[model samples]
Target: MTKKTRYGVKFYSVCTTDDYGLNLQIYSGKSDEAEGLSKIQTLVHSLMEPFLDSGHNVFMDNFYNSVDLSGKLLKRKMHTTGTLRQNHKKNPTAITQAKLKKGQHLSKRSKNVYISNWKDKLEVLAVYH
Candidate 1:
């Protein structure tokens, strides 16, 4: 008999704001990646609809990065900022020769930057820790 491997696993997470950092909302489920994302979107919409309706800013990680997701949040009038993954390929020009001229310095850097869909450009910033 041949052995089979299970590909899906239950993912759990607690979504909250940067200000408070911890809120009493936890979600867990056993599903594929797409289903997990859909569940998260539904949960976020339900929990954050009021805040979004009142014009609040919502910060998220790149895991939730998508044009559709961004559009949905923007439709609710919420601003967002997050560290986008390099593999996202949202900004092709962001990794040009000019930007990567100093390969060594750039390789070990994780800088605070702003990327916008409107302009599709990156603006690096100096943030105080």
Candidate 2:
């Protein structure tokens, strides 16, 4: 349930949200040469092949969400909802550092996706498509 990376020599494992055992898919961080988004895409494809095009929604955290990945998943008929890192490719720059009050939020949408930023104790960016 654990895999190691070559660059930072990091290790990762998939844990289930429920109280069940850990998820079987063990994904190491991408190799040192792999690009950020490409690495995420590769891992997702490998782990989600059977579920693609099945109209399922995949929820993920910042480590696994990105603009490129969200669009790709949507094309395969799968939807994604999750937090995204601000520096991800094609992710909007306007809200990355924008300061929002307690209940303020910013949102934008594309043909098949929507992105939003909410401010609480800190800024949170969410993407869904």
Candidate 3:
């Protein structure tokens, strides 16, 4: 098995699986950790552009989750569904502090959630399964 890290000389690969097994088509060495996203974006754009351009939903983990990156993917007309970090900021429009009347009943979910580093608020969607 090959390990993937943004800092080392490792191979990043994308694979397709079927009844037989996994087929690896692309592999490239990564050089820098800071340039990881841009490098991956370039690779994905070059190799997976066809699939992505077809409007397939791309799922990513929190490590690759960010508003800027998400916005870029959305710009390409690709739908994004990923697990956002728990500390992710809430959307400002979703806050209801202005509608509160002194001591109104407040549900836990209605509280204003904010992240210091995040400029805009994010809409939180909960899915039970």
Q: Give the winner by lDDT.
A: 2
Q: Which ten residues in a row have the lowest lDDT in candidate 3?
A: 110-119
Measured against the true structure, the TM-scores of the candidates, in listed sequence, are 0.45, 0.73, 0.40
Name the lDDT value of residue 70 in candidate 3: 53
Candidate 2 is scored at a TM of 0.73
Per-residue accuracy of model 2 over 2-72 as CA lDDT, tens digit each: 88755544434343466443334554544543354476677776666777899987788998888778888
Best by TM-score: 2
Candidate 1: tens digits of C-alpha lDDT, residues 97-128: 22422222221212323343221245231111
Clash number for candidate 2 = 0
Screening candidate 1 with a backbone cut-off below 3 angstroms (N, C-alpha, C), the clashing residue pairs are none
lDDT of each: 0.46, 0.76, 0.42
User: In model 1, where do residues sit more than 4 Å from their true spots?
Assistant: 1-23, 30-37, 89-99, 103-129
Least accurate 10 contiguous residues by lDDT in model 2: 7-16
| Total backbone clashes of candidate 3, pairs 3 or more residues apart or in separate chains | 4
Candidate 3 has which clashing residue pairs, if any?
A: 90-121, 90-122, 91-121, 91-122
Runs of candidate 3 with Cα error greater than 4 angstroms are 1-37, 85-129
